[model samples]
Target chain A: MVANIRDKAAIVGVANTAFSKDSGVSELSLAVQAIKGACDDAGIHPREIDGFATFTLDTNDEIEVARALGCGDLTFWGRSHYGGGAATGSLHQAVMAVATGMAECVAVFRALNGRSGHRYSQGVSGELLTADAIHWGWYTPYGLLTPASWTAMITQRWMHRTGVTKEAMFEVARCTREYAVSNPNAFFHGQPLDRDTYFNARMIADPLQLFDCCQESDGGSAIIVTTPQRARDLKQPVVTVKGVAQASAQGQEQMTSFYRDEISDVSEHRIAAGDCYEMSGLRPSDIDAAVIYDAFTPNVLLQLEAWDFCKFGEAGDFVLDGNLRPDGRLPTNTHGGQLSEAYIHGVNGLVEATRLVRGQSVNQPGKQVDHALVTSGVGIPTGGAILGKLD
Target chain B: MTPEEQKAFEDRIYAYVGVKVCERTAAKDAVNPAMIRHWAEAMGDTNPAYTDETWAANSRRGKTIAPPAMMYAWNQEGFTVTRGRASDPQTDMVELFNEYGFTGVLGTNVTQEYFKEVSPGDTLYLEMEIDSISERKATARGIGYFFETLATFSDQNGEKVGTQRFRVLKFIPQEQPTAATGDDKLEVPTRIPSPRGHDNGWWWQAVDEGKLLIQRCKRCQVLRHPPRPMCGECQSLEWDSIESGMEGEVISYTCLRHPAIPGYPKDPVCAVIKLAEGTNLVANIVGCDYDDVFIGMKLKGRIEQVDEKTTLPQFYPA
Candidate 1:
């Protein structure tokens, strides 16, 4: 049976450090600050945070973070792999920990000095510890190094088959930038992306321009999760976890899964979407807003299609129709997403999902958000989760 | 180069797009059993469909048939391709790039989408068109231009059997020290060497000897690539290696361009090849124009020394 996680756990608090090109501090400092801020927002003491969950790529260790926060004897710790793909999976682990009584309170956090210390956009180099590098040997020697190039290879095929063009991709960037204009924390706040500016932007890879890529900012984001019964006493509105799941579809291989039958298909996203919906007893139509991962603009379109927000090959048209706008059908990335916001991996996205559910988003849509869908990265083992106000 | 000169070259090469390289070149011989048996023997393929006429005649095929990958082999120009054929748009394009300082050439990728199967006695014809050309850009392979071509194959009755897309790069070779003498040479960047662990070291060892080997399960007779200790079909540790025919067709490919990696030519065109042995291998295609490589295009592999310490399986047009 699917785990009956609906309404079992609640996000009582969400917080993030200022998004910037350089944090001027170690990733551990950012993690401790963000986690402490989250606990304060939840009306809990730092000592109350008994569990820690994060990404494998996170430089902060659970014990280090726990010690910094003065957290009591930790009962649960979890780390998910695959970068942004583990965003929701980290939360899924926290929810499982709280719901099963393995831990009373769990903090799911991600901290990165992406621009200052280790810029991810620069591309892969040096020795890799993961076995995925074994397969990457085939493409790396050929200059297929960066995440942008890996994404472009798959996006190019999708565009070829679906007839989607850069114009549609521009809509995703432009729309997300509009949301950022109102979000003071967004890196692109007060700056708007025009069509000509987007078109003239240098190509990172064909079909993906500078604006099509997300910001590599140094920041931290954390969310507090606990059983609904305990969360009822928290300071913030209860944003319950409706559904959450992680999936690694067949033929999965990090970002270089070119050997699959259909390179464009985000099978992991589709499977995770199906599982989340089945577990929550909710459908795409119920999602009033979404913050699909935007590592690249094309990924936004691919995930929109994978989650069935629109029919396959219709995501371009959907965005072109203005569905991603604040006043439109399904307002998305209200805090500008990774595109205009800061890239704190997917942690910040869950923070935005919580804001949408609480009707506290800076660019809150005119319509009430009953449920908001949030997903992690694509072209790798990935995941998603649904958040909504408790009934 | 002057901006005007760059514009002139761009216009000239871009003009080749949509131009036909070959209209209808017929295969030198009809599809026959002799070549099929030879290919099967070289591939170590015992599918019975291509070799056992009685078994094939009684099966769904109703008669002996050729492997779909054999489509390009039937029409290969053999030795004539080395001298460059007259009136060929691909050759003309390469000449135009070579006319500029971009003299180095590398076949990058090929992708073939098969629609039908060809049988013995069926005659084949080939047609090719210049599909697209890329602008001159900086790459790890030095400054270069990339071009692509689409090749379509059809049977005698005019039924389309397959189409292939090939990409090639024409570039100026980057300068580097030729002498392999310094201790820092080991630290200097080179092609990300293939990981040869306990399970697959023997395979890399064979490639060093100029052979491509596929692991065969001793019990089930299943062939697998990227060798492992156990067979997936049947749980068995007993396995042996079969020297691959090396001749194969491009199944899929890509030309990587951004964040140019070290120890690699600019815009390395990578491809997955379906070996004649009925297994797949990932190898670089070189010594031909990138656009001239395409799906279903026949290629022959040779283990070549790429750097001081590395010898890898690289492919060239058959």
Candidate 2:
């Protein structure tokens, strides 16, 4: 079931720490600072916030956040799993809590020390030694253990099935960095990448160059959600929650979905996109702009195909044609995404969605953004949310 | 070292490559709740679902679920020396190289991947197989021998669960003189005793009685080594201690020229002996040279009483 928060709840405030390779602060401190900045941006007191939502991987506890912010009481607290997939889901939970009278005001936050702390790019190891960990035993024995290696398997299969070239994948990375160059807050801001640079980048996993993967950054971002009436009375114009949905396909494994019927097609994205579109009462053509999760460049194309934004295997051509550019139809990741911006588990994607609705984005698209779609992590049980201007 | 010794060393080196020993128990049902809780605490996951049963009932997945990463938390149980006793190194390769005398070994990289969900109540059957063995010329860490081993785990129904590929590097001691391999002869004793017993103040009393015993479920007739309370096959609590013949045939064997485990003698010969009663046991094959321990070799079990409290089961050619 989908809960429509259109004109009922809105994101009135948003704030984030500086995105960088290393932010010399604890994750908790970053979270608290982001929360305080968001609250201040909305001109609301901390005592008014009654709900909190964040990622399960986030180190900041709800109670601790409340204590740090001097919040009076919390009526709703929630956490979403599946890494970057929970970015929009956290907002969805906050919006639901505010709309249903579960909480008067809800705050959604994500704090991560991605680079200097635990780097997922280092590959999956330690604490993964159980019976289930043995499944990768077959693949790792042949030297395929990293996340890029896992995704490379699917990318290779996708390439073999479709005549998509490495040039097509590079185009996606190029477009993302292009947007990043214009985003002042982006870690790679002012730095643009080209096809040659993308191809020449170090090979992290086979077929996946270093630039194809997202940059690990230490940062925190927070968004405040309140009822439309309350949001209208606050500092910013009410940006309605059009629709949100989370989906997990059958035969799903955590990171390795190799046993699925089709590895190239992300079934979770297809299912989530269907639900998000149906709930929003909109189609792919209706989305003026989007923030497609870019944990990996290939996943961006996969999301486009799965959501029917482009036909199957047609995303390579669509992306190459500058369809995802700010001037093109359906501008995506206007804030550089996880690839160019600091990846805070897709939280910054949601922030970009809010910016698109508020018309405050650095890489603002030409057309009026009536609807902005945002997606969560791609490989696992992903999530999606749509934001629209209040009627 | 004579030419025969060098030939024996080469033979041992070849046999150690891609060798594996299987643990009889299944993966799914072998989960220990206490162990899962401990790992969850270590990971700093305070989700009540892993601890509180009431909270778990309301969880999205319904039942209490172990954290996704908790499935890889099984302590490595090494090869069994006797019916109920096993041998494991006191320290890991990294720890031994870091603190102890093996100084040359450095630049260690470990990579692991996950395949399936290791839920609670799943019995885990583990099989450790040596994937490859390669020797590199003297690096900064003396002469290094790289051994890659893959451990495959399966559930009770024999469904493949996960796999672990471990790369171990053993640095040769600088002062240790290169020993002749062929001169190392396998020693076998005449009489073998059964290593088994119930906890009656002393755990391994049956080994002193000169009989090998295994706990058998009377209802299902399932014989279980490393005895537990109930029969994993039928979940029958009614069990009787049964004595089996010490003689068995080797299903697979490996002669180790490099010490994978620290403090153990270098080039020790290990074999997975399939007992006549249809159970496989892993132990050192004694009383035969490294060249003689081949697949399907017949061997008889002998009890080597280590001290007043412990007895090790050693096997030799029958």
Positional deviation of B37 in candidate 2, in angstroms?
Answer: 57
**Model 1 over residues B1-318: C-alpha lDDT tens digits?**
898999998899899989999997889989999999998899888889998999998999798888877777888887898896665778888888889888977776566778888888899889999987776766656798777788899999999989887777788987746663355323333677767677767887887788889999999999876666898789899999899888988765556555555456555666677789887776778877667766668999888887656778888999
Writing each residue's lDDT as its tens digit, candidate 2 over A22-102 gives 888899888988888889988899899999999888989999999989999889998888777788878878877887899
Q: What is the clash tally of candidate 2?
A: 30
Q: What is the lDDT of residue B184 in candidate 2?
A: 50
User: What are the lDDT scores of the predictions, listed in order?
Assistant: 0.85, 0.72
**Candidate 2 to native Cα RMSD, angstroms:** 21.6
Pick out the ten consecutive residues of candidate 2 chain A with the lowest summed lDDT. Answer: A135-144
In the range A263-353, model 1's lDDT, one tens digit per residue, is 6799999999999999999999999999989889999999999999999889889999999998888899999999999998889999999
- How does residue A150 of candidate 2 score in lDDT? 62
- Best candidate, DockQ-wise? 1
> DockQ for all models, in order?
0.19, 0.02
Off by over 4 Å in 1: A131-133, B1-188, B241-253, B272-281, B285-302, B315-318
Alpha-carbon error at A254 in model 2, in Å? Answer: 1.4
Q: Write candidate 2's Cα lDDT for B29-136 as tens digits.
A: 367567678877898888887766677778775656666455445644434424554332212333433443344443233334456655567676777766765644
